[model samples]
Target: MKLHWSPRSPFVRKVAILLHETGLDAKVERVRSVAAIATPNAAIMVDNPLSQIPTLVLDDGTALYDSPVICEYLDTLHDGPRYFPAAGPARWAALQRQALADGMLAILLIWRQERMKAPGQQLPDWLTAFATKIAASLARLEADAPALANGHDIGHVTIGCLLSYLDYRFADLDWRAGHPALAAWHAAFEQRPSMVATRPDDAQT
Candidate 1:
């Protein structure tokens, strides 16, 4: 297997963490790729039309993309345990949580991309709207924190990566201000072997 990846991508990091947790890291080859709105890598487009990082190409030349789909596919390769709970309320909850976390990532990426443009080309209202969504998303996660368990798989990993990215890229937001439970949970979660092993270079910001 080959993975078109970038160390700085939170989505790529999510997949990296998943591979590590499943003991599948050594099984896949990592091919460095850059992906961004301002500078999209044409090489990646050969495998993924969107030129997205974290695109996995299987042995038969099948390409899996984005984060969630890639994670689900990798989860099936291992038999040790399942990150995606089988059908039931738990499964629905896990999927829901993953969606929310991914949505937050999208909002943050939008915020950063807009700010990267020249000030004259940026829309203050759009930036403000993205900020609002990011804040609301954090508040929602904070509220959903206590129920979080240490053994969580994909759902928990999603939240962990998103919060870490926020801390790394949006420190001015002060997300930990009143989110005690979520902060505490994240503090412990970051120590997991998967996270510790894949911590990106400081330049990831």
Candidate 2:
């Protein structure tokens, strides 16, 4: 399998963490592919029309895309504990958490793009809305922090990645200030071998 990957993408980091947890890191070859919202890469578009990272091309020319689908597909390949619960309330909760985290990530990506624009070209309303949404997301995660200890799932991985991304790109926001419980949870999760190994700063550019 070959993965169209980028070192800095949280979505790609999710897949990388899963690969490590499942002992499948060696099974997939990483191809450094640059995928930007403003300018899509032709290489990635060949595998994923959206030009997204973490696009996995299997041996028989089958392609799996977006982080969630790829991670779930890889989960079936290993015998270890499942990152996705097989069924019941646990599965729904995990999936819901993943959706929240991924939604925040999507907002952060666009917020970042907006930040990159010249000050005069930036929209004030959009900036304010982005900040508001992030704060609300943090509050939701804070409320759900206790449930995070129940099990390590795709939700945990995705949330940890999102918090780390905040530290990586939005340090000025001081996200931990009002979310003590969530911060504490992330502090420990960030130390996992998978998380440490895939740190965006530590990745080779």
Candidate 3:
């Protein structure tokens, strides 16, 4: 398997963390592929029409994409309990949490792009919407942070990766100040071998 990857993307980091956790890192090769709203790479689009990274091409030439799908596929490739829970409430909660984390990433990336674009082109309405969504999401996560037990499943991995991105890109926001439980959980989660090993080394996209 080959993974279209980028160190700077939180979504890609989620997949990388899962691969390490499953002891499946060696089974896949990482190909550095950069994708962004303004800068799209045709090579990645070939495998994933959206031009997203963390696109995993299986040995048989099948493509799995966007972190969540790739992580689920990786989970099935390994023996033992899956990062994705078996059917029932456990599965629903994990999927819900993952979706929440992905929403945060989408808003964050768009905000970052807005910040980078020419000041005149920046949309205040868009910024307001992003801020509203981010605030609500974080508040919800903070209140529910206690549910994040020690399980390193897909939900936990997605949250961990999102927390890292928040710290890296919006450190000035000081999100941890208002969210003690999440702060504590992430502090411990960051020390996991999978997370530690996959930490982003570069600030560049």
Candidate 4:
């Protein structure tokens, strides 16, 4: 399998961490796809209409997209118990965690857009919306960080990526300060080899 990849993107990092955690790193090849957001990447758009990174092209030439879908596909490829439980409350909880993380990413991207444009081009309304969403999301996650009692699950992976992104893009926000349990959870997750390997360099991929 070939992974359409870029190291700077948090979404891409999520998939990379999962592949590494599941012991499938050797089986998958990482090809640095063109930068679609900063620069037009026709090849990626050809494969995926959305022109998103972390698109997985299976051995048979089928392509998968977006971080969540790619991660789910990776989970199925593994044998034994899945990182994502197949039934009941486990699946719902995992999905909820993933959604929260995904929402965090979306808000960060919006903030990035507002920051990147000309100083006078800032979108105030959009910034306010994104900021509110991010604040609420983090508060909830901090208050009740997902439990990882039975080894690492998809929820853990999602939260790990979310926290890592905050550190990478919005370190000044100091998300760890107001939330002690989340801080503790992130401290433990930071020790994992997968998290270490996928740590954001923020120095351009």
Output the number of the TM-score-best candidate.
Answer: 2
lDDT of 2 by residue, 1-205 (tens): 9999889999999999999999999999999998877898999888899987889999998899989999999999999999999999999999999999999999999999899899999999999999999999999999999888889999999999999999999999999998999999999999999999899965466
lDDT of 4 by residue, 37-124 (tens): 6676788877787778988999998999988899999998878568788889888888888888888887797698787788688888
The CA lDDT at 114 in model 2 is 92
Clashing pairs in 1: none
Sort by lDDT, top down from the best: 2, 1, 3, 4
Per-candidate Cα lDDT values, in order, are 0.89, 0.94, 0.89, 0.84
As a whole number from 0 to 100, the lDDT of residue 173 in candidate 1 is: 84
User: Per-residue lDDT of 81-163 in model 3, one digit per residue for the tens?
Assistant: 78899899889989999999999998999898887789899999998999899999999999879999746579999999999
Runs of candidate 4 with Cα error greater than 4 angstroms are 146-151
Candidate 2 lDDT: 0.94
Where does candidate 4 clash, by residue pair?
A: none
**2 or 3: which has the higher TM-score?**
2
Off by over 4 Å in 2: none
Q: Tell me the deviation in Å of residue 80 in model 4.
A: 4.5
TM-score against truth, every candidate: 0.95, 0.97, 0.95, 0.93
